[model samples]
Structures are given as structure tokens and as C-alpha cells.
Target chain A: MTGHIYIIGMGPGYKEMMTDEAYQAMKNADVIVGYTVYIDLVKEHFPDKEFFTTPMRQEVERCKACYDFAKDGKIVAFICSGDAGVYGMAAPMYELLPEYESQNITADDITVIPGVTAAISGAAQLGAPINHDFCVISLSDLLTPWETIERRLIAAIQGDFAIAIYNPSSKKRHDYLEKACQIMLDAGTDKNRACGYVENIGREGTKTVVCTLEELKNAQVNMFTTVFVGNSKSEIIQGKLVTKRGYEI
Target chain B: MTGHIYIIGMGPGYKEMMTDEAYQAMKNADVIVGYTVYIDLVKEHFPDKEFFTTPMRQEVERCKACYDFAKDGKIVAFICSGDAGVYGMAAPMYELLPEYESQNITADDITVIPGVTAAISGAAQLGAPINHDFCVISLSDLLTPWETIERRLIAAIQGDFAIAIYNPSSKKRHDYLEKACQIMLDAGTDKNRACGYVENIGREGTKTVVCTLEELKNAQVNMFTTVFVGNSKSEIIQGKLVTKRGYEI
Candidate 1:
């Protein structure tokens, strides 16, 4: 039996948005490993596969289970949302794979397929918030220091780059997006910048709104929301949003 | 007769990569307009519809033609590769729509749908250069000033953001990517950064390589290539690329 591991990106929570490549990989796997939420998302596709689920923040232990099982020649798949490489499970698993390889316990068969990111999907629902030049930053500082996040926010503001803010805020990190907006306001003209918030992308009850930096500071945002801040070149045109590419007259 | 304009993103040339929503929109269009190259890409899908093709640098004229025909209550689509909102015909058409509306041209309605972007497709093919925080910058100064582009590049480097460089160089402008890389080298550690060149993503003859910034400059690149420059956290792991989110050990 050839032992293999496939990392799949489920995409913004819509069955239609999931790529055919990713679906095929999932169907071929004998064992599926992921967070409980992600497993629930794709449970219908793998009704008969051996399913392994982990609670939140237990990534290391869950990945170890897959690695141990793969050593037994099991066809295993680790699932993620969006692209597996973008804040997904691929990195953590890669880090641990070396240790297992040193022990000669796992084969070198790992493949990662890409999926549509929430940032792009959310931006699509609204007008183009990322048309010309832009940056995406995660406001949650679970791994990175708050100071680092602050510096990136200030740099994005000075660069005049459109920005996508992921993991904007959760129950414990409620003030991060507020601080980000404040940094932008202090760096330049607050009224000139445009901001948008998209919640539950590609899922039912999706909500999106466009506002200014000042308005965004007080906007009701959550972990499910992805916010976009337009650069100086972006504008609201007759209710249709646009970020100009500078070539236009 | 309801005049409507469906601005469609054709994805990255692979029909399987195209979302079902985008395909449905194209199928419903009665008259499709786009640049000659993109028109040729989707010719097979709409053999019966009226196809209008324009030469390069004739965006304004092409958009005018789309608007004029759409005013007759036709289901018109302006085709573009990737997503229509990103570096596509949607922005230019949106900019010119008001001028026509002011002149009593009210018969046409407009809708813009998102398509997969070259940056995402390129990142996917190259193993996720956009896993964490990243930025996208176009090296072309046709519509934007080089000074503005320089400032953004400086900011992206200062923030340690991963970057995607589009339109890096053409026949007339070959020094943009070199100049941009120099700016990054000046701001960040030269040896630690990783860069990738992904050409013709999702299309035949697709080629991708992950290397250092120095190596990328020495490598052959062209207009079809989308370059990804990883920040401090990116690494080339066992020939499979990965970008760390700093969330893991």
C-alpha cells in the first residue's frame, strides 16, 4: 500500500466553490483528519471514510494522529478552509513531518491543492476592493505580537495599499480592528479611505457593508467577518465600488 | 426587453477552475464583448452569440460598444480572464457608465462578478505563497506613477508582507521588477526572502519555480509570469513551498 497525505482546501463554505481537484482528492482518501467544524462541513462527501476530528486549538495532536496512521500505509487527508497554505493546516503539518521523517516513520507523499480564499470571495461579493494594489493582514495576534500587527497596519496605511483584515475580532480580541482603524486615521486622512466588511462569505446570511475608516472603528465586526480598507485611489461610484488602477482618466 | 450587462470573470483558462456561478452567467449572456484574446478563449461556449473583439489599449472603445448594445435590452457580457473586477474590464466600464447614463442611456443594467485572480491561481500552483499576510503590487506604471509604486513597495517590505508582482515587465518596460526587487533588498534581509515565478497558471505550458530574490532576477521571466516574493516567514520546504502564519511553533 502506498502511504499518502492530501491537504485539501474546502473553500468559503459553499459546496459549489469547492474545486473539483480538491473533491477528487477527498474522495480518494481512506482516512480524513481535520477540526471538528471542517469535518462537519464535508461530512456528506465522506460518509464511509474513517473520520478523525479534533477540538479547536488541538492541531498538533491531530496532525500527529494522521502522521502515525500514514506510516501504516493509510491514505490520509487533512482538510482546511480556503487554500491550505493560507493560514491553514499545511504549515503546522509540514513542521512536524520532518520529525516523523527522521524516525523513518512516514513516506514523502504530501500534496496541497488550493481553494478560493474568503478574502477573495468576500471581495467578489462586494465590488473589487483588491483591484490595483493591496495587502492582507490578520488582526488576531495569537501567534504574532500585537506590536508586529500594529507596525503592519501603519505600513499599509503609509503605503496607500488596499487592505484585507482577517480574523478581525473574536470574543477576546475585540479591540484589534478598532486599533487598526485608529492607526490608519492617525497616519493620514480618515475620510479619504473606504472600508468594507463582509461576514459569512459564500454561506447563508452573508452580510456586507462599505464605509469609511472612521465609521469602521465603531462598526460591529466579528471573527466571521473579513474587512477591506480601500487605498486612497478607491472610491464609491454611484453605489458601485471601485478601486482605480491609475490608468483611467 | 431588459437591458443588462454581466461582467464575467472567465477564471484562469481552465474550464474546471471556473465557478458554476460564472459559467451560468456566461451561458445566459446574449451578446459578449471583450479583447480579441479573451474573446478567442471563450469562443466555443457561445458560438451563436454576437462576439465583439477589440484591439489592445482600446478598453474605453470596447466598453462603449458593450454599453451601446446593452442599451437595446440585450444580455451583454464583457469577458475577462481571472475575475472581471481585478485588472479586468469592469473598472473601466464602471468609470464610463455614468457618462452614458447622464446622456439618457438608461436601458442598460450592469453587474460585476468575481473570478479567480492570477495571484491566487499563481499561489496555488506554487504551493501557497499567500498563506499568511501578503500584498499585491503591479509593476506597470502606465496608469500609476513609479513614485507611488515605489512608496508602496517600501511599505510592503517594511511591514514584512508577502508580495505578488503583476505586469512585472513587458517589451517596453523591462526594469520594473529589477527596480522593485532592489527596493525590497534595501528594506529587508536579502538572503532570507523567497520568491516564486508562476507562468500560465491553470493553462497549458504552466511552469513554476520557487527560489530566492537573487535567483529570480537571474531567471528568465516574461509578461505571462506572476512573481511572488515571500516575506520573512516564508520558506521552501522539501521542494514544496509553504508560508507560515506565525501562529505555529
Candidate 2:
């Protein structure tokens, strides 16, 4: 017999934003494991379940904890913010599955419940900035190289796809957004191209801004901000950003 | 008094896939309106609510009807599959709001609740093919020009980012997916690159296929399919596709 693991995306730290599938998984799980921040998001709702958490930068250990709990025949819920598959813990968990199996402990059943990721949820606040083709790039360089992020930014701008920027700025990467905007501008993008960002999406102190590329370049932002550089067709209508489906409109 | 309008993304046509907010909006609305196919997906669950529908290619008429119902001070729910803001009725409805106000009937309150979109939802079925950066391009040239879509595909490939394609093929555009693969191949994409497609996502007769770019070029896909071409780091691990966050992994 094997234990079951549920890698669930909790969706922007709000219960209302989570899918019934994800909620049911949480209810079915006997144990929940996550980063402390994500676990605290759901601790109130599932007070009866055994909870385990790690602070940030402890992803490897977090995955190991979930496997250990699952190996003990507990229905383990490995939770993460946003869609579990997108920069969440699902891939890493799946990557480590073989390691656990080599110890004669198996978690043969793993279910991934998708949730509203930041790019899609943040776009809800700014109207429809991703109505057409769009790309999502992270400004954080912790896992990815800065050069790769820069090239992706240039490609997104050159492709004329509306770009959603995750982790736009952190304490160490305060100037990354400016560098990205410069790459876009260097690509001959119009300085007044429509742009916007949503800070702390679906959380307390949520804020939104709609401006041109020039304004976004100088805008104050933090790691929680989901920024967007709109396409050539993006516009500010009624103070909201919208990228229409067709130019004929 | 202006009535409220709730534009909700029903999320992959599954009750379990819908968000609590979308379900709540469905329960609170006096009536629900949508495309005929999408309405049928939720008709049984909320059989007591009044429902209105329009056939395909009648988006303008449908948006007008939602405004008309809202003007009558009814809690109108405008529902669509997947995230409402992404190629759904929200923008068009918002775009038409001013016109409805010209008739001296306004909907001053409209809440846009985001749900899981197909790209992210479909990714769950195929594992984590979007772990890092990704772009979504629809091959349907009905709304956007074909040349523009081709450029986006090339850019996504050149950027070395995973690409999720929406509306990959329709009755009139059955060859579009093939054309997209050819564009990638022409732009120096390896023929054996990891790629996948999910058919009828989160619905009956759901199917997932993981294969090389060469296989995808000739794969039989319909309108219901969501396709993807992986980045350089993408791989098939235990028959699951995953584009890892970092190459070192």
C-alpha cells in the first residue's frame, strides 16, 4: 500500500479564489505541509490537521518532510501559493519522488490541483491586460540567471506580447524592473505604451496602478507586485488597462 | 439603482474546477447568461437560476443582453469557461458598458472574479511544463492576424521560453497547429524538443499526450486542444513533462 500526496495551489492566499478541487484536497488531507507563510494562510481553516512548515529558502527540506509524512501512510497535502505547477512545489516534489521510493517508501498517487496563478489573478485587478497573446517572466534572479531574464524580456517586447512580470523587485533586485523597461525601450517600444501593475493581489493592502511604460519604469514596487508591460494595442479605458482581442474594435 | 454584474470564469467546465467566488456569484445572481455550450456545463448544478444563452459568434449580442438584464436591477451573472478576463466576456462587456450607459441605464457595480485558465489547468494534466517563463499564443487568426501569431511563435521559441498555445486549431484552422510547429522548426527548434497537448481539459473524454515537436507537428488536434512547446530545459521524466525552474535541477 502507498500513501497519497496532494500538491495543491491555494490561490493568492484567499479561500474565495481557490477551486473546489483544491479545497476538497485540503479537507481530505490528514496532514498539511508548506512554507510557513503559505501554511499560515490555511492554518485557520484546517485547525484540526497536523501541520508542518519551513521558512523560506528551505524548499528541499520541505519536500522531504512531505514525503516522510506520506510514507507514514498519512494523506499529505503539500501546499503552495498559486498554481502548484507554476514555480510552485509540484515539480520539485515530483523530482524528489524517486529518491523516496529508493528507500522502499512509495507515494504512487499524487494529485495536482490547479489554482488561479498570480498572472491571471493580477490581471483581474487591471481589467484585461492579457486579452491577447501574453508572456510571464519573473524578475527574481534567485533560481534563474539575470541574463536569461533579460533576454526573455527583450523577446517578449519584440514579440509584442503583453508581458506579466512576477517578483518584479526584491530587496536585492530593486533595479531589475528599471533594467527590464530599458530593454523594452531599447527595442524601440514607444515610451507611452500602456502598462500597469497590481501589488499584493488578493491580499491585504492591495494596490493597482495604470500608466505608460515611462511611469512604470519609475514606479515604486516590491516583490509582491505583479507588473505588466502592455502590447502595442493595449489601452487605458476608464482608468483600467485592456488589450482588446482585435484591432477592429 | 444600477444593478450588479458578476463576470465569472467557470474554469474548465467542471464544478470542482470553479472558484468559490465564481460559484458564490452563480448562486447569488438572479440570472445567468453565457454561450450555449458553457451554460450547459453548469445548468444542472444551479437548475433553479434563470439562464439565458447565445450561440457561437454572437458575443456582441450576448454582452448586450447581460447589460440589458443588469439595467433591470437584476443580479446578472455573465459566465465563461476559464478565466473570464482572458478571451472571455469581461473586456467586451466592459467595452460595451459605456454604450449601455448612453441609453441612460448604467451598471455601476461589476465584479470580476478570476478563475483557473486553460493554460494552467491543462498544465496540471501534463505535469509542470511551465515551471519557469512561458508565453501563450492562440493560433486562431479570427481575432488576430496570422502574421502576428507567427511572429509571436518565433519570438517565444527564440526567447527559449516554454509556449502554451490556446485555440490551436478550429474547423477552419485545422492546419494552424502544424503551421506553428513548422515555424518553430524553421527557427532552429530541435525536432525532438519536449511538447504536449491536452484534449477536452477538465471535461469528459479528457486526453493528454507527451511527445516530441516532430510528433506534435502531425498530431490530430481539434478546437478543444491546448498545446505546448517546451524550452531547452524541458524534459520527460517518468512520462511526465516538466520544464524545470533551473537547469541545474
Query: For model 2, what is the error of residue A216's alpha carbon versus the real structure, in angstroms, after optimal superposition?
Result: 0.4
Tens-place lDDT per residue, model 2, A185-230, is 9988999999999998988988999999999999999988999888
The runs of at least 3 residues in candidate 1 whose Cα sits more than 4 Å from the true structure, single-residue gaps closed, are: A1-3, A45-50, A65-77, A102-108, B45-50, B100-109
Off by over 4 Å in 2: A103-108, A247-249, B103-108, B247-249
DockQ of 2: 0.63
lDDT of 2 at A36: 89
True-contact fraction per candidate equals: 0.48, 0.61
Quote each prediction's TM-score.
Answer: 0.91, 0.97
Tens digits of per-residue lDDT, candidate 2, B1-249, equal 367888898999889999999999999999999999999999999978899999998888888888788778888899989999888877776677667666665434677889889899988888888888999998988878899999999999989999999998888888989999999999999999999999999999999999999999999999999998889988887667888876333
TM-score of 1: 0.91
Residue A227's C-alpha lDDT in candidate 1?
94
Evaluated at residue A224, the lDDT of candidate 2 is: 89
lDDT string, candidate 1, A1-249, tens digits: 367888777778877777666777788888889989888888986789889988988878887887877888888888887767778877776666678766564325777766677777777766777777888899988888888888899899889888889999999988888888888888875764777889998788999788888888998999899998888878866555567765554
